[model samples]
Target: MIAYYVHHQGSGHVHRASSIAAQARTPVVGLSGRPRPAGWTGDWVDLPDDSDGVDASSRDVTAGGTLHWVPRRHAGLAERMRRVSETVARASLVVVDVSVEVALLARLHGVPVVVVAQPGERTDRPHRTAYDLAERILAPWPVRPAGGWPDGWTAKTVHLGALSRFDAHPAPAAGDPCRVLVLWGRGGIDVGPDRIAAAAAATPGHRWVVAGPHPGPGAWPANLTWLGWVDDVWAELSAAGVVVTHAGQNALAEVAAARRPAVVVPQRRPFGEQDATAAALARAGIAEPTGSWPEPAAWPALLARAAQRGGTGWDAWSTGTGAARAAALLDGLAA
Candidate 1:
């Protein structure tokens, strides 16, 4: 049996975990702070309701424009842990995804942990301690400068490369006309309705798809297709000529694997991590940063540049086996 600790921060964590779990031949359960997305194949423990006003760390679902945060019920954590303990009691190993408390509890129950994280995202001391407790730390990026990781963790750190949906399918057909994919995850804050409308109106010739939690029904423009949350986005990506999206790790990884070019619009926070991701893609010459939207001229030029560099030495990252490799390392720790 395997237990997957899901934070429900963004779809990226769950999205990556699903691909990995598909390769696993074990019973897996998921626990999240928010309601599970559609088609999750694990036993779920729903989080407490948040009827109160939004706080600092709240997640804004674009559809209703409401900010969501992990509910803090005194009984909730305890109850969830009781369930986790029962599951872990029969598990060969536990895989923790960026949750400090979950990692600690798994250790308390004598279950070895496997951590899934991007390279520079693991700077926290608690996470470092979790890395120490884990049999292996799986990083989904190329072996560049070791940023944000603790020293002497090299023995446990494995560069499993980028975990992506593209790895599950063949690369996009060569020589397709340029189409763009625009993904906005931290919606309402990052990419607003007006901006999406402007972009859609500006570029009529290129095909575009906007995915993420929908901001609202009437918010979308007719030129762009809206998918609330996509279970499989690769078919659209494979058919696309370019990707115009938020600087999500998953989005970048997918486009990179498809060997397509991208025009990235960095998310202005309240939602962090977009800037780093966008800048990295820009530096690699796969995508460029478009600070503001509604610029039809700029987008075409950026997309053109991306297309010229398509399928050019992009797979030099890590092999496409991060999850299974990480899982095997975790199993050895339990042994």
Candidate 2:
């Protein structure tokens, strides 16, 4: 059996893992601090959440800039690694999506590592070490610009494109109302309702809807609707004429699958991860990057520009066979 190490910070990691695991040709086990996702078709073992009692001021969490989030003197970190180390004997390979320390740990234990790559300026020493130790690196995006790294890192990577839970969902029905959807990830972002209200007020004609957590106080504007964490997000996404979302990998894949035009507002991430994706979209003419959340006046033009571009062009971003191909790759690795 192969072990899949999914990062617990955001829902995207688990979403990607679930899609690939569903199509895997071999048995797979999931390891994360998160609870077992609802539809994962594999054995799941919960690892300790490393943030518990983690005080960055107290100790060098980065191990003096050589790693990411390896906080010593933390109980959670110790237990988490211990649990992860126990799986070394049973697994032939470990797919990390993604944590550098875990990838290094798996490699040290003699299990081959498939390191999932995120788009960004990951030329840092920690990232270079992880990629160097990896047997393979899986990138979940279409082939595009490499953010200026050594050719060795780029050579080993297999660009598997994007994967999403809504991959099987059909294209959104045509002729939906002229509305704008603001989608956010479960991963904490700073896009506030007050800021959204200002934009919603500017585009009074277009109905504005928001998904994910926005715990700000105040009754919303009449034109704006807040559907806090809906189960049927695809329904909302499908019915919209334009989607305003962050440039997250999962969100982009879902938008690509829904076949709706989108205005991508990239959230600030470590190593400028989302910024790199937004730039790629601009370069490919798939979507335009607003750089940051647009001002109230900028909303009208941005939304209109995205609508005019249309969503059919996203076929290149998500070919609907990414998960199948990734699963086949993992199967070959297991063999």
Candidates' C-alpha lDDT: 0.63, 0.88
Tens-digit lDDT string for candidate 1 (40-156): 676765644333444434433221322122344435545666776777777777887756666767878887777765533555555566777776677777665655556767766
Write one digit per residue (lDDT tens) for candidate 2, span 74-168. 88888999989997558998999999999999998999999999888898989998999888888999998795777887888888888888988
* TM-score for each of the candidates: 0.78, 0.97
List of clashing residue pairs for candidate 2: none
Q: Which residue pairs collide, candidate 1?
A: 62-214, 62-215, 63-214, 179-241
Candidate 1 Cα misplacement greater than 4 A, ranges: 25-27, 33-73, 119-121, 186-189, 213-232, 268-272, 289-297, 311-313
In model 2, which regions exceed 4 Å deviation?
175-177, 216-219
Instruction: Point out the worst 10-residue segment of candidate 1 by lDDT.
Output: 60-69
What local lDDT score does residue 155 receive in model 2, on the 0 to 100 scale? 89
